[model samples]
Target: MRTTTAPGDALGVLETAALLRELTAGLISAADFDEALAQLVRTCRAAVPGVTWCSVTILQAGEPASVAASDEPIRALDDVQYGDDGPAITAIRERDPVFVPDLAGSGRWPRWTARALALGVHGVVSAPVDIDDQVIGSINLYARRPGAFRDRQQLTAMLLAEHAGLLLAAVRGRVRADRAQPQPVAPGDEEVVGHALGVIMTQRGCPAPEAREVLRGASRALSIPLAELARRLVDSVARHHPG
Candidate 1:
């Protein structure tokens, strides 16, 4: 997104630039991800009259997920949006700001549309939030009146999304160490396995399969090679560990 530039409002530009600098510096120092995300939506809604409410859904590990929201009717959309597991997922794949002028008539994400319709919000503008080319999350703006967001409002939403990404990445980087689910280690470590195999090629003087097994055994025992033991094993002159 193009940053706010080409200004007649010198003070506004300075203030905006200052704020951007401050935000960039603190992007990774947010207090809490959930609170920060909710605040982003709140800030968006307050800044734009048409947007009375907002919500944030994130892609966690290639799957759609909702982090936080205002907890109104739109709150229900999370269970499905969590993994792009539902229709609302369309908003995620859509790069341009989506202005749902009328949720009831909007056929996109049928289930999501139905839920939002129940909330009494006539429209919403959702935009993808990106940081350093990575799409971190999306911001959804809700309007009490039908067809509230104009082209200008949509543009503002995109601008809001940029800052949102900075804040979230910062907040999430910290919170993730605590809240993220555990990841498993692959059964066989690639580097050690390959290194062991290479070691066997020189010491075993055998075919690939035999070398692989020899390396496997040595690795499992975590054996340290001794001179005598190393000599006992056959050696291919070309194979050498450069000191």
Candidate 2:
């Protein structure tokens, strides 16, 4: 992890809260661990100014895997990291946040940096997802311009990565529960599904039945149970905008 000491203004209280609100909403609405991480990367890419790409790496059964990315091109960048040492791998190993203000002169990870430069990535920030003293993975953010992620942006990335740890912990709990017993959608689950349908209708500009199909399609695509997906959507909206 690269450390820096620079004078800069921190994010405002309300501003930080707003950003966190978006992330928390994403977690609440996600159908499972993978979707939650996907939401995190998407939110970080859009919310963090100057971030061109974002990706999440998690250790799946002791093997590193790039779980989510902001765009397709980011997979290539992540692949380079998986092949050799990169900021993300370093962050996970050190259990700290790493900021590469400029990859042009970086000798720390030559091969990976060269690949990143060729891909038009000039800067990088990797924050470790440390949960209960265990490093689960990392969140990598890339920029097209050097020095794009300063103190403020690095702090934001670190905070979000910390939230990813919490999400992982929740996922572990859910997995344990899932293994304990199969949860069947109850009668009340229909209402949850209805709310999810309404959300899909608005997002897709489709009718109720069409939205229902959309939910069904997503459930099938993600291999998630229909009832579970519906509950996640409703929870995402309800928690984000409580009455």
Q: What C-alpha lDDT values do all the predictions have?
A: 0.59, 0.80
lDDT of 1 by residue, 1-243 (tens): 333433432234555565455545444445676567666655565556567777777766555545566766666655556533332355567565676767777767675666666777778877877643443567777777886766656666676677867677766666645433222224454454445456677566777788755544443344333232233332432355333
**Full-model lDDT, candidate 1:** 0.59
Reference-based TM-score, model 1? 0.56
User: Least lDDT summed over 10 consecutive residues: which range in candidate 1?
Assistant: 225-234
- The Cα error of candidate 1 at residue 135, in Å, is 6.6
lDDT of 2 by residue, 66-151 (tens): 45888777777787777798888898878888887788868889888887888899999899886444338888899999988787
TM-score of 2: 0.70
Which candidate has the highest lDDT of all?
2
Which ranges in model 2 have alpha carbons more than 4 Å from their true place? 1-8, 132-135, 183-243
